[model samples]
Target: MPLTGRNFLYLLIASGIYFLSARFAVLLFSLEPGNIALIWLPSGIGLLMVLRFGYWAVPFIVVASYLANSAGMAAVLSELAWLHTSTAALSNGLESALAATLMRRLLPEGLQSFQDIFPFVFGVCLVSTAVNSTILVVNLVMAGFFAVESSWMIWLILIVTNSLGILLLIPLAQAVLQAWESRLQMRLGDAARCIALFIICTGMTWLAFDMFAGFIFLIMPALMFLAVQGRKESVYVTLTVTVGLTVALAAENYGPFQLQTDEWSRLYLLSYLYSLIVLVLGTELYQRDLLSEVQARQSWQYRAHHDALTSLGNRSLFIPLLENEMKRAERMNRAFALALIDLDNFKSFNDSFGHALGDKVLKEFAQLVRKNLRDIDVAARMGGDEFAILFPETPMSEARHAVERLRKQVEKLTIKYHGRTIQFTISSGLAEFIPHEKHTSDAILGRVDQLLYEAKRQGRNQVQA
Candidate 1:
């Protein structure tokens, strides 16, 4: 979400779409038909646009509001209606602008995920909606257009409508946009099946809403089906069908909510709010659990491939890495070197100092290898006192110098063990991998092992190349 001239254009277009949709919804669901919408969407659109673009988009709110109000008024009243409604529309523009500004001031950092939606819903939504509603009521009544006795009722209606719009519309829009960005191409069959399912569900919902309101319960299977599928498009489509049907049915007073005409608005409002919350939270948590499972699996895989004591790559990981490096080197026709390191007098030292100190020596030696080698090099614990290092793109001469420096670093190391300072030395064997003179990983490994044995035989604390 960055700001550009093109982004400003998109925001303006989006504001128009949101304004038109809100006007349409209002016409359908207005308690006093043809005058005002029970739910006004401009507030939500304003906040959302500000979040997506930047503060510059706030002026679009004024234009959308002015046009929406002017058009709505022109359809019923004379041109003079614009004179009165313009002031009201100004409040709306200010309402939306205030909502967006408050949201920014309140959530400067913004939400990290849907999981962090509560505080935002509470603090910013409530306060901003209150500001917008109050400004609107005061603005209209002061202009002598709005009546005084019904002011409280209008205030309450505005609050509920604005809050519902913010809560339901923002996340729904987000899910749809996310699906679009995922670049998932639908196959012919997939598209057909999804559309067919949507039509069937819509038909069922229509029947339930028009005739047997209890049949609305039948949509639950489809609802759960879409939710469990866990695709953003699926979720957004399901919400569209469900919300569309509910609004249409409730508007006609032909649904389950018709049983109590006076309570339909409040009850349906709460129901929509609750339904969207459940759908959004369920989708987010389900995806989070899947991600957690993947991360946990990766953690176990890492532990499986690493030496537990030294926290270095063990035989399992090291061998494959070496093989892969060899293949890559061969492909590029580059040279690399491998060094096998064995701790000198390690067996006798462990016998004298106990296995605990022996584990310490192994860990310390791994750290020394890391500190000595270039970032391009790979180091691993072959096991116990044995280790290996791969120096990518290094010649035999460079490898020898690097290994000698590591040997010197190891020789200078000191460890405190139970009131005593202890020290150890390592003997290393080096071999350079030549691309033209190719060999299997096992052949290279076997040659390095032989050189390490020769180094040990010649007397410990020496490096053989």
Candidate 2:
């Protein structure tokens, strides 16, 4: 929708979801940042909200912050707390809005597919998160609200988690939306595969941590399998589940990438990067599938309008063109000509030799007829050994000249078939429509067809206008 009251309501609902989700993330994953949380989802979801709704939703980030911040609603009643929370919320909202803005400017296809994935990964994930984290940290330090001892750690955590949230989580949500709109169709088999793959990956992750620490890369193949075999939704669901389980396992000191450090930032960075692989590859697969579908559609359309043997416009495409030209010439008081071409003794070529050579002769003869025509002229294969040509805005003299020139070319043309040379000639009839002649396409074609038979009756190797 539009910028209406209902949209504001949607903004509120989205903000509420962001608030709750961010709070839940903080409660589960906290470090030395004093409840500042590692996986900062509010910012990522804020970006999604602005992209989904409009920039008008940015201010509601404050509402999300107030509801989710460790400092409760009562603390916000105080002047100092209110100022601090407002600053943080504004910083979050502005950075996310900046991400949406920069992505709009940078991504060529505007967040649609793999085409725009690079810009989002760089602009929204890395650059936007870095800006947000830096600003928030500097603000807290200047305001003396946060201790400066662990400022670097806080910044690093914010950057990685924020990037993870945007790259990993946002795509999951985007996939669901695409599936809802029927843009990305997910089959039951694909969903089943994704679930099974996730289970297998989780088990492997558990085993790798328990037995072989070096085998931590086991989830890669599973995710890659899902990305290759599934649609956008299945790839997204598989990645999300894998990330969640791996993070949970690593956080609890069960996974292999568990460096002995107090902050498990390595897992965050590595897991995010690996998940990045899945997202990009999955989107590329989707793009290829989409391109294949478009090509298939275009192929069908071409076959529908064109002759297979000659690769020329067929009857299905010719008549409408004639009608359009008729309408235009009638309206503008201009002139156009229509011609029908029939090759003499064409059946002898097929019967004496084979249909293959006859087809080759026909194709060559069609090309001969098409020689030296104006851009607005149309040539079509009416059927076996019969063709139609249309010349828009041409008078009878030029129309007759074009037909005679093509006939002479057909006379000289020769097709070589298996050490034998097949030679042929064409008989054609030309019909011109002046503005004064109020004729339909059928009437003109009928008259031209009669002229063609007349040329044949008069002895074949000639043109009659």
Best by TM-score: 2
Under the 3 Å rule for N, CA and C atoms, how many clashes does model 1 have?
1
Instruction: Identify the candidate with maximal lDDT.
Output: 2
- Each prediction's TM-score versus the true structure: 0.59, 0.61
Write one digit per residue (lDDT tens) for candidate 2, span 68-100: 764642342344666667777877888778878
RMSD of 2: 16.9
Report residue 224 deviation for candidate 2 (angstroms): 0.9
Task: List model 1 lDDT by residue over 127-170, tens digit each.
Answer: 77777788778766665556888677677777777776676666
Candidate 2: worst-modelled 10 consecutive residues by lDDT:
70-79
